[model samples]
Target chain A: MNAPTIKPFGECGFIAQIEGFSSDVDSGLFANAVARALRSNDGVDDAVAGIDSVAMRFDPAHLGVDDAREMLLDATNNTPRNTARAKSKTIDIPICYGGEYGPDFDALCTQLKITADALIKLHSTAPYRVITLGFAPGFVYLGELPEDLTAPRLKTPRLRVEAGSVGIAGHYTGVYSLPSPGGWRIIGRTPLALFDGRETHPFIFEPGDEVRFNAITPEAFGAIRRAQK
Target chain B: MMAIATIDRPGLQTTIQDAGRRGARHLGVPQSGAADRVCLAFANAAVGNRWDAPALECTMTGPALSFEMDIGFALSGADMGALLNDEPVGRYQTISARPGDRLALGAAQAGARAYIAFAGGMAGFAFFDSVSTYMPAGLGGLEGRALRTGDTIGSRKATMMAPVDIPDTLRPHFGHDWILRATEGPDTESFNPKTVRHFFSAPFKAGRRGDRMGLRLIGAEMISEDARAMKSSAVFPGTVQCPPDGAPILLGPDAQTVGGYRRIAQVIDADLPLIGQIRPGDRIWFRRIKAQTARQTTLQRQILIASFVSDFSLR
Candidate 1:
């Protein structure tokens, strides 16, 4: 008997999506479940999932879309959500707030009506969840920020937002690892570069991981950067 | 012999590219490389360059690059009206550019991207296992940025090499007469039959917003009646993503590693190079084919390449 819960995803790349859960809860369960479901399928070239859906790319040269969809459905229904299988890693990033290190730090303080010290404490208080990543290379999008800290992007994007600069856009927050044009509200700069193109494993953070930002004095930031180097 | 030119005026988008970096998609980094793959390949062939060898990919037109060293080079893809020191150089062919000679590329006369190939090879910097440059991440090429006015590029040392003797049979002088083949996607049936028919039947124009990431094909809007949201997943080059807006976005070099949009069709691998050559205002149409046929075509091309490489490798 075939497992019967899989459904059709859009046909662009021959993807069949497995039903999933919310990003906030049981995300590990979802990621493992999705990966498990598509692991053994010959038709599936790759499998990636969001909080609510798991998408698979089917190589038609290998199998038809209908067959691929059926295969994914069978896999999802047969396999159980393995939450305990995956462990979340928490990384502490030390950032230098103001001065030449962060160009938009002062502007952010004025806009949010919060002192730098208070912002740091609140930011560090909670473990930010990793959301989806898409804007640029090795860019990780994290969390719904603290309620008061939520802010829109600049009307005109800065020509160059230095890499490792921490930024916020609405409820979403992220860090720029590469120098690219972006419209996020810049709050602080992290001297640590997060993305490197040449390395085999160039990315530090993936979606669904937890992260905490620890504010450090310029001296500490410099010390960490040097140590990493 | 190997040679390179000095930039007098860098055109809109001039960068050195090879096949681009692979396996960086999981991290949201797109594999960026030659925007016009077919023409880039032809130019490489004209000068006996390797398929994945580094070459100058000039966008729109190109900067007036002066020869820093004497070398033979070939230009292909969109005719950029490329000239050497005020004299018109041959298209789909290699010519000599001596030191101090300026290679001027003017407005596009045919296509958007033009490739400049060196005989010995190109001077390259490494990124993601390849020399292809991704501009956004500031990786590859001269500091991961476009070539600028007054910038100097070192030419390949061709002391042991000579100007490649190109065969006239390999030349693709004008555009058109080429048909792109496509295969059904993993999500082919997700869209209603009408939308799928509209895609294969209708003719589309390459939009002005086209970039290395993807081409925004302008034509009938293909809407997915199913309002269900899609999960982010791995996307490949030439994946035809149909947004709710109804237009098809042809993912290209430098495209996102993953996307959440519904994909309707994937341009076959053989046809991806054709898409790269398509510039703004260029006309194109799609035809769906079975995977078997597509695979056969790819295999045929591979056999041809293997035979040529064995007999007369660019190296």
Candidate 2:
């Protein structure tokens, strides 16, 4: 693994950028490890993992900027480069595709020139890895979508996208954990709650977690949604 | 808990806010809080409350509220031409009200936001250890949303300290022209030297699309030398991100945890509150400063504030 270059992020934080790091499962796991290690230290306010970088915010009152940079460097150097040993879980998501739940479904199928069944088969057959969680609380970014499954985002984003809405853009698929304005092409909807602050673990997916989507009927979606409530 | 006031008019966008939600950005939560922390602290201090006590944050327009019980409140930030019982009231000092008294504020005469702090602190829904409202996710505050007409505001009871006045030297001033001190961002090298130099030299105007999320700056197009799409990375309040269109978006308190735009500069921590007071058509200039200087300035400002509000830290 290439060593990350440390740079000052504003006056109270440092961001470690790993050059030539791909947005893949292994890189995400390594970044997550480094962020976790940094967060454990005193004076670290927040340690967040990006696609190929780890940014840490520190309290300057407790630690100087130079000391914070050193701490970030030490955490990066000490974290294991090979993240295969990292413990991650596989989560299965049941999705209701097409019709009302997916407003852009027919348009996307026509744009991609694929039959509904073919598209669903391609999307569900392959397993994906969580690259990161961001944009909003519990919003999970899963990556390496099948090339044929990729689609450009909407020109004008919808003002309100319901929570659990599944969307595709460029090389990745993401789940909107909360109702928010989004531009991604809608493909499906999930019944499971992706975020619940009441729970000890608020997020459903973490970096490097394996994710598999399974097709389900609208009735099943309603049933699962009711069960969760 | 008891109802203190009833919202007569909700105004443009009034929401409950505090210091903000911290230590949850790693979970993709934005630090939703008072857009102007300095003013929030001052308002709270004037009412003899903790610096982080929950308060009402009114946008360009202020709300009309009627008190249901005797209460003490203070106002800070934008001069909103507040009136109590149809009589003009002063700001930065505590004002007592009796039951049935009405408090109303007009459109801001200067800044964009104003804060109203209650004597015993306002009550709101807490999420991630803060009452600050993050409207996008509908978390925190009163049902995690902005105040509306007919909403009854609640308050927490506590042994109150005598109301005090904030020193004039400690109060912040707002104007149409804003000069913000900043440091280089993580992606500052992505732009050419000429564009980087132009960023410092040029003056930009705040666009009408300003909100708690961010403010769009309209000025010279700052096209990046590297046209490759940037990977999503950690972003915070005050990160100046430039998109493909070259328009810079200055992130605010409600900025996303990660973004995919090219970042060229980061407004220093000390100057972040100024971003809150920026109104549409406001002229802004970014002044480059060393990281050490930014740190020193923040420390000095924090010391001054701490002397007035004990245990208050700007960071």
Candidate 3:
């Protein structure tokens, strides 16, 4: 693995980009470990883990930028033992695919030259990791959506994609926890409230969590929604 | 209930804000707080409240409120033609309200957001350790949303202090043209020399899409040498991201924690409050400064704010 490059991001932040990562799995684990380390590290204000980089904000008053950089370098070299991938949570979510719930179902299948049933089976079978949540609040980016499912984002994004809209962009899948403008191809929807500020755990998927989708019928989806209410 | 005031006119996206939640970006939380933090802190300080105390953040339009009980308040940031009991009220100065007194804030004639801070801090649900409202996720503030008509904000009881006046020199002025200082961004190398030159030299107009999330700017099309898809990285307020279309988007306080666009520069911390006051159609010019110089500027601003707070006891 190539050594990570720790560089200044803004005036008060530093990002460590781990280039030439051995594999997606290894990078995910490393990123999560680094993020957890920086989050708890004294003097660090904020920390976010990307695919192969970790961005950290610091209070220059408490710790100078040069000192923070050195601390980050030290943390990167020594990954904490307690934050192993095994400590991550596995969450199974129920999704209603195709029909009215998925606007781009037929179009996506036609473009990929795959049967609808086959597509659903392939998507539901894989266990995806919670890579990051960058775009919006509670929005979780889970990946690596079987390379076969890799697709480009829409040329023109929709003005408003409703909350719980499950979308696939590039090699990842994500759930829009809130209504937002997005370019990802929507393939399904979930009934579960992925984000609720009132709850102790506002977001269902945290970084490092493993997620798998369970295909459900429209009736089942409605039943689950009713039960929650 | 310690009802202090009832919102008669909710105004445009008025909400309670504090210092905001820290060390939560990994949870996809943006530092959602006052757009112009300097003003918020100033208003809070004038009323003898902690710097991070919850305060009302009025948007382009201001709200009309009726006091349930006597209270002390301060108006700062945008001059939204504030009036108390039909009498014109000045900015940067604390004003005392009597029971049943009506306070009104009109449409912004100058800047974008205005801050109205009460003597005692506002009582709102503390989500993720802050009262600052994060609108997109419906988190923090009153019921995790913006203030609406009929909402009666409660206040903590405290000894009333005499109103204090902030010096004119300390007050920020809203102008048509703004100059923001910035430092180099991570993706600055991705842009060609010509684009970099245009970024610093050309003046950009704040587009219609300006909001708490980001301010989209229209200016000289900045072309980058590498059009390859860049990996998403951490983004913060003041980050000037240039998408494939070459238009720049200046991230605001409510911006996404991370993004994929290439950032050429970041507005310096000291100048961020100025960006928050920017309104659509305003002209913006970026001035490049060294990272060391930017740090120094932030330190100076911190000292200035500290001095102001230190004088609070004397006042």
Candidate 4:
């Protein structure tokens, strides 16, 4: 479901209005420019660039909201950004599609106008770059899927989307790395835990990493889960 | 050194907290720390612990706590009729407790969040560098949820902590007067002058759904400028996001990493705890403060906290 449209946000901490599309090029360029500016800016922290908008945080204690906003304004408008490949990554995620693991497996097939077999092939064929990580921790949004595959989110969010459930919303496919309420059309599940608190790097995938998902069988998934435990 | 407090009866959303994950935004994690930070700091000071150490962050109604070891503790913020073994344990003052003494709190007489601090910080395993519980990821503080009956936590004697010397005159007392300061926002222009005036003039209520993420305030329906199809963007703590429904949601410690909604204002850093103490049905007014003033105040506050450690002896 689409959130109702409204006025633009904030004045100083970030830019007010900017037009950028969802196309790979538009999204990529906007993200890159914002990221570059944030990297260059001395005042900002937790600087994040999205598909069309960029948001950065600073200790309002050090960089006043006015200064923070102005800094972002300069980055978005005055500073020219480099349009280059995001830090490339080849993260391999082992998944279990269809059957019980993917409760929405059959649902995705019906919605996408394709069979289960074709759906998996379409998804696995592409190498998706990380669009953004928001909503929840370790939740990775990857996409630019086939247009026919695009659809709105569920009118009602599911009560519980198990960790590792892969979903699609508005041409974007995402994997839930934690258990939480979600609305995407889940098409598969991954056995390998995407989140590792024990890892030196807790976040398995970053905003700029490149990713390719590999499918696995349910039995193999069970064995992997057992071995990890 | 372990001091135990048995939960006689657990109330709503009481959990362990401290200075939450300080630098987790790079990993898309919202810092889920103490809701009312000022009170937590004072409570820590009262109990002879570091200001950043973990403590029990209790919401409106908290559980009846019974101590199982000889220890000292204090409660700061929100008078909830707290008592030890049916006798009152003074607010903002250190109180000694014996093993098996029951401590209880009733309805809040003032604020929303109350801090229960011990001589030592909350005894819990660390996650991402702090013990603040981020419930979404199930990290930190006793399985990342509320404290329940039979939950036992240990504490170590504070090594560097000194008895807080704040005078009673400076302590917060229940009052009806409060004015919050906010910094300018990118969307300030979008709001008509009349609407801006209304925002400052009207009294608003913190919605019932308020939590660590953000408190949803029910006020005048704010209209976005010319109706724009806002693209999804990054948001931060203290961001005041106005959804199309016209309601204002002020982001807090656990605010989202990104949002597609329009933002109207960002609360100045110094006055954030003001929002934290705002309870449902409480009224508040806003004033615009220059960022420079806010930055200066932030430094002053930090210096004030830094001055409390008794071991400020030359290294």
Model number with the top TM-score: 2
Model 1, A1-229: lDDT tens per residue? Answer: 2223454333323333433444423543454355545756666655654444455656565887567767666656666555523546877777777787766777888888989888777766777866655557766667757888888767787767888888887666788878766778777778776876557767777666777888878888788789988
For each candidate, what is the lDDT?
0.68, 0.89, 0.83, 0.71
- On a 0 to 100 scale, what is the lDDT of residue B211 in model 4? 79
> lDDT winner among the candidates?
2
**Residue range A143-209, candidate 3, lDDT tens digits:** 7889778888999988678788899988888888877668899999999888766777788887778
TM-score of the A chain in candidate 4: the value is 0.82
Q: Quote the RMSD, in angstroms, for model 4.
A: 4.9
DockQ scores for all predicted structures: 0.33, 0.83, 0.62, 0.40
Full candidate order by TM-score, most accurate first: 2, 3, 4, 1
Quote the lDDT for B273 in model 3: 80
Q: What is the per-residue lDDT of model 4 for residues B268-306, given as tens digits with 9 covering 90 to 100?
A: 666676666777777766676665676666667656555
In order of lDDT, best first, we have: 2, 3, 4, 1
Residue A70 displacement (Å), model 1 = 11
Q: List ranges where model 1 is wrong by over 4 Å.
A: A1-16, A20-80, A83-85, A95-123, A129-135, A143-161, A167-172, A181-188, A206-209, A215-229, B1-3, B156-169, B173-179, B309-315
Q: What is the DockQ ranking, best to worst? A: 2, 3, 4, 1
**What is the Å distance of residue A183 in model 3 from its true position?**
3.1
The sequence of per-residue lDDT tens digits that candidate 3 reaches over residues B1-315 is 599999999998799998777766777778888888888878987898876678999988999999998878899999999999999998777788998999999999778999999988888877788888887766778877788899999996544444445678898889889999998888888888778978998999999878888999998987678878877788988999998887899998888887888889988888888877898899999998988888888888878776775432100
